[model samples]
Target chain A: MSAFDIYIKSINDVLEELKNSGRRINVFNVPSSCSELPRTIPVNIGGNANPGIILRQDTYVELGNPEAGSSAIMISTNETGLINDGRITLIGPDIPESADKSLPFGQVILIGGASLDDKEHETLQQPGFVGDKIEGYMIRSLPQNIWSRISKDGAAKGFNFECLGKALIYLYKSENPKIESMEIIFITSAKDDVKLLDNISEQVRKISKEITKENWKIKGYDIDCELDCSSCGDKSVCDDIRDVLKSRKKKGLVK
Target chain B: MINIYSQLMSAANKSLFGLTLGPQNESDGPFIMGNGDFFIEIPVAFGCSFSDLTLTGAMGTGLPNAAELIDKGTEVGVESRLCNAIKVATYYLEAGLLKTPDMIITTNSCCDAMDTLGNLLNGYKPWAHIPRFNMHAPHSYDDASYEYMGKQLRQAVKFMEDVTGRKMDMDRLREVCIESNKQCQLLLEFQELKKAKPCPAEPDLAREGAEFKNWSKDRISPQVTEWLEILVKETEKQVKEKKGIEGVDEKIRFLWQDLAGSWASGTVLARLQKELGAVCVMDYVSFGTWTPVDLSSEEAMFTSFGKRFLLEDPMNRQALHTTDLFCNDILQIVKDFSCDAVILPAHIAHRDTNSRIKVVRDMCHEKGIPCLVLGIDIWDKRYMTPDVAFDRMKTFFEISGLL
Candidate 1:
């Protein structure tokens, strides 16, 4: 009946649809205490005492901006346990500390579920949908990148990474029943620390894309080809043969 | 023991071949290069060699490894979301495989990828020594936009001259413009021949395929003019002889949008032709015109060049303007070429054009023209293998009752 409930329901429907379309779905369950966890956190941009979602104008800059280090990484792992369900870790300095400074940013989301499979690779990578679903969170660039903004109103209501991480866990748990545990990690402290995680994150992104491309291949789409047609000399002969085969098919003789 | 004259000629031929392939080294002199989507009219007119970095990377002509270059670019911090073509160009430059241009010229005609790549190139070590000229195309096509583009054209010429130490010879520019206009006329005539019932140009798939493969190399040379003339003559003979592609029954005619996956091994066009009796008689890359320039005077030539680049280059036009053009062109081309359907190759790199697919699809639907959007990456065949593309086309043709 509530807006938040409706949003949760819509996300469930999307996950259900993906499942019905032969994509494996994964959902993890967390302790009921996770939902009741306090939303107040000190992730505000200027160390402000605002609640809910804090608009951190100084916390992070656009990746491509000269001020920003232009480093980004996204990591997802299935190595999880039941106790770690809905657990989020912030390894680096909070937003207030890095305000007005360009620093490396990293995000890691770990999920554990009973039914998770290679087919559900994209399903787990659906955290990008959170930026759109959250009423006041405005992600400036692609969610996979660190360029994001929060509405002043949301920040005043005490918005922080804890709130976002909790919301993600709630959504995933509510949407799919298969997930048994989920954890979100944020690293924005120092460039050296972020760099190590970023290297892994980059590898994860590559593997995820390869998985998606493989899925397309299974569904009958060739994401790429292996032939070097640019240098081929017998192209005309091949074209002639193909033409003849096509003609026979058109005449209903080859089919 | 070769004669000195013979040795000199051989060396010259080798150098010319390297230039045709792409800028081989910094010593190749002040070359002007940019995205292939924009017109290189001014650069060509300035007597400077023009290289389309996107096409060079796509064809893997001079690069040590196109895929590796793309990876290097991503590792160096270019956004992975950027199109592979732009990434490949950036990688090639960063890896020292591509010779840095004396000056980089580009227009905000297509997408943000160009801007990102241009910025990265500007910061790259090789390009830091040179200047990068960025031209902003107006959103609306009018007299004002034409004038603005004309000013940019003149500025670009000056920049080229400044970098190359060459004077802008009005007489030489006019001569090149005349030849370019002649080439455009020949191209238009060739397009007209596609309206024939059997389609005169359908049989020359091999030649067209080769041209698409070596698109970058062939563009600036007189060889393009010769090829166009040969195509015109061949099409004329086909019209006289009433010949189409040898085995094709020509049961269906389709208009291919932008670049098709013709670079792929089996090719989307070849698949459609063979399995469903569909002939892609016209495609955006080959059929689109770069409106003829007037060679009467210096001002007239520059104005014509500006108008062509601003109003005629499809990638440079506004989104709404481009959609309208697509609708109008598809409608007329369908009737003119007797096309039964439209095949819009949704090239992943061309995000700007991909956004207009729904509009084109709806227009075709209203007109009772069946349109199929094939998800393909034109430059990279790995994005859509020939078998996969063929299966999709076969299904679409079967549903449309063209098979």
Candidate 2:
């Protein structure tokens, strides 16, 4: 197996191990498209010669909706499988045309295996390597939006959602055989539809960040502070936290 | 007065044109770009026009929609907490409002935000293909840092020459340094004169001194020198007459800490003088120490420039050193300017300086000086409105009994 495939397999192995530990696994999938792309894409966009997917290519691939402005890719997996949402919706402009306007595109993958203890949570969610497996598509990740581009020639050769989605499914299944079921939704439509997707994605992103933060705290890592310490009024609390963490280190509980 | 205003306008127009249109002229000399705080002597020595990307991006006039320009950065995922000054600069590049420079020279000592902005700008189009020289300003001033920064200055000079096909004239650099020293001396003298009981000069004069230090490259012009001389003479006359800023009673004299209060409008200053008995006699930008350069030695001139870059540049100083300077200045100026209390504007755009606000405040408290830290945005008025800031200032005065 390639390095990318190996990485995905490793993540699946962790999930499988967690599943064996009798923990409930839950996964939620949300799909949205290009209107949200511009908001996430770097403002300094210009001609990039790097090998990735450029959305704006000269081809005719039934890009479903010209007004599809918002897009998101949100994936969340936890110990409880009771919260699984298996809804799959694929609508909007075709792959080729959607690539032309530099529109937003989103894909969310949810995986749930078995519930593991606190120690296994970190291993349960390993960074995925599917981004590199897809040829000629460059993915720029934001909080709620995953903006990507298809190369000019890639679009001409008929790289559409079907191929992209199928590739993702194949990669996930092959890598994480423990993942019992998978759901995929691709939305390519206009204003209100995109907004709905954005709302879901924003919530999912926030939840995912919170989960990651909690995991880090459990693992004895410093929680990220968004505000600068100088201007913050709660410096006393922050200092207390630091002192506790420091004392923990002195006691040799944390590595 | 019209002649001076016309000259200033003419220079501004030339600068604006050079920033937007001049780059399109391929045959013209290569553009040497840096942040606003870069040493002006090196660019002058190489006979290259300096492009301060931050200044051009934030303050460039004739924008159809300033809010839209700033919003462009937000759309690109630049966090709102980052310095608005930097965000606007990034927006200028992203929107193509500011053209790319032929080469980029940046120092990493300003702040994390500026370093990130520099990296983004360097990778952006037009500038993406150009040669970039990155220098690190050490956190502490020492012999090793001096040698290192001085070497970087020399390397920067060489880089400019390589890119622009121009040769550096040591003599010209020496002349620029001498002129810069003269201007510094005049500024220092004016700052001392500000200590008079009834301050002769206003905040506008301090702003003029800041502009002259930031922009003027050649020798201190006769007009500028004469203007400072006139202010000094007039202030001396005021001292003789025992007057205080015309009709105002000068109830409380304030040393506005740092660049935060420097952005207040003339109307704002007027209101403070007319309404609240508070006068901002000194500010961070106007009160920077200008280390005189020894013109006789070329080595000394370059070393002085390096020292200035590492030690003197407000943005480049180490965090602790910066706080120390602020605290020390507050104590010194409280006595020198005979100030009642110090007002720290706590500008949001300046994260590096803002980070030291707590330490400075604590130090002030220990020293028995009332330091009011007002959270404000120095550049983008939209974030913190003038009325809101004015209200806060009034509250501070009331609490401190300055009213």
Candidate 3:
């Protein structure tokens, strides 16, 4: 199967564009399963063990920071051969080569498996963005636009592209066993390149937005109102209350 | 995993949802406030179907017409400066949006908005003919004061008997008291779990259950108690696993002292957590602070209710009584919860809490706990939007070196 859901654009276009972009791109292939990756970083869920810390003074590099430019996306397809199992592609400079600098970063994770469905796009997204889940790697809020830091300690410990890629591979493979083929692309070349990734990410986000609401429905959260604000006069004011309450309801808060 | 607060609140709400209207119970049909109050117990003990739409109607800011309803209330007679909660409640009551009750039991240990609202409902033209009883709370907290309120509660029971033409089941009320005590115990255990490092729960979750605060404690059902049991277990599991709010690094932990707290759908805290790894460890609703009531005698039951009424209720504890309780509670929460800062939301309607803000802030600062006073209404976002509150906090964090 070559064409699958959530990949509104063909995967070949991404490969072709990266090859023609004149940027240095390196591909490192690893073992297919998480158990085979180097034991450099384990899955640290619930937050960075030392949160909001690793002060700016302690960070050697800030990637895809909002100040520079930030873009990220996780796209999945059930097509065979579309994803090279355990392949990590770095389209820009790696950590040791680009220290003491803030760079526009772009990350795109391509996953492929026969059992993958469009409904689980968010479930796929959850573990793919390894925030504080990786040691000494602290990511600033929400991953839709990824901004992260590599602590000085982490860099000194040889936490480079290979280690980072291996950590990602470990987390994705461990959390999602059904993922048969996974390929990651990291672009720290230019803001324009990150924007290029963002443009492609938006198409998938269109489908993502709908599936997210579907996920909410499964969790017993709904609009909770009969009136369509599209026709109401006080839609703007009600919209604020509606959005907040909807989230609260998702958490099972009382009326 | 679902956070501790959401699990418990959902369990608390679901356990009590349609409780009085359940197939197993007969209906007397009473209307009461659902602001986590216990006055619903009188009707609940009598097998009454509680049709309280206060929260269901206007107080649910989710309702599309919430703002419209509040505005309508202002247009009628309510002052524009009044709380949006009471404003919308007034409009809905006048509009007959909520189902009318056979009898109304109004308790006023909380605030003026409630007291005035009770007064209006008691004398309102449409509801005037409805048999009503008032438990006017006095400011003093002595034996005579509790005796006065307890006497009112007894009279309220008599009034209930006179209206429903049904005799009070002493045994059922006793059983309800016993169940309520169990809820208090479970609540304490649940609260104790929050003191865990990394705070194995969400901030807003701790900001709920105000409805379970006082006289309303007697409305505690086995489901709520069992749910609380489950909540304790769930939180315990999280603590054992060393779990905390997902993705939060927890560099900073603070206590929120808002009257209604931040109802921004977690936007405020979510931003703080994402940007700074800052977490709100506890809020005013953090603890089930009240102890179990004495049930050895019928008179002790009502007197305990009065004690919980004046001493445990938010309004009586912080709003009406001395500023000492207000400052003491804040300082205590800061130490108990291991917080780095405090956010005291200055709700516009809570002038009493607002007036004592300086005292609370100075005390917190003197103890090296950074305190932030925000000009926002916790229940009504129109006063200060979530984005604005978040920006203020971000600035405060920067100034306080918590960034």
Best by DockQ: 2
lDDT per residue as tens, model 2, A1-255? 011222233334534544465433333242222222223322212233222222222222322121234454434344324223333434455566554453434444544445323323333333323444555544432112344555555566566665455455455545554544444555544434444454445444345445555654443332343234544688788789889999999999887
TM, every model: 0.55, 0.57, 0.57
User: What would the per-residue lDDT of candidate 3 be over residues B1-403, giving only the tens digit for each residue?
Assistant: 6655665766544433333213213343544432224444456677765444334332345455556666787887877777777777677667776555677676664566766677767767876677766667777655567777777877878887888687889788888777777766555555555666787766555334434322222246665666566666676777767888677777888877755432654567778777788887766655445534557678977887776677665456666565544555676566545678998877888766676665565566656888898888766677788899899998998899987
Give, for candidate 3 chain B, the lowest lDDT window spanning 10 residues.
B17-26
Error of 1 at B204 (Å): 7.3
True contacts kept of each: 0.00, 0.02, 0.00
Going through the candidates in order, state the TM-score of chain A alone for each one. 0.57, 0.52, 0.76
B297: Cα error in model 1, Å: 2.8
Tell me the TM-score of chain B in each candidate: 0.84, 0.86, 0.88
Give the C-alpha miss distance for residue A228 in model 1, angstroms: 39
lDDT of 3 at B329: 64
Candidate 1 lDDT by residue in tens digits, A1-255:
011122223333433543465532233333434345323332322111221221233223222121232334323334434235655655444533343454445555556655566666565454333434454444332223444545544545555556666665665665556666666655554444444444454455556666655654454332332112232466576668879999999999897
List the lowest-lDDT window of 10 residues for candidate 1 chain A.
A45-54
lDDT, model 2, position A207: 52
Give the per-residue lDDT of model 2 (tens digit) for B1-403: 3434234434534534444334532225566666555787676555556666666555532244656766776777787777666677777777777655678898775566677777777778666778898876676554457667787888888888887677888887877676666666566556655766667656446555545555543224455565555555565565556666665777878877756432364445567877876888877656555556645466656777777777766545433243433444566567546678888877776666666666667657865777888877666667777777788888888888777
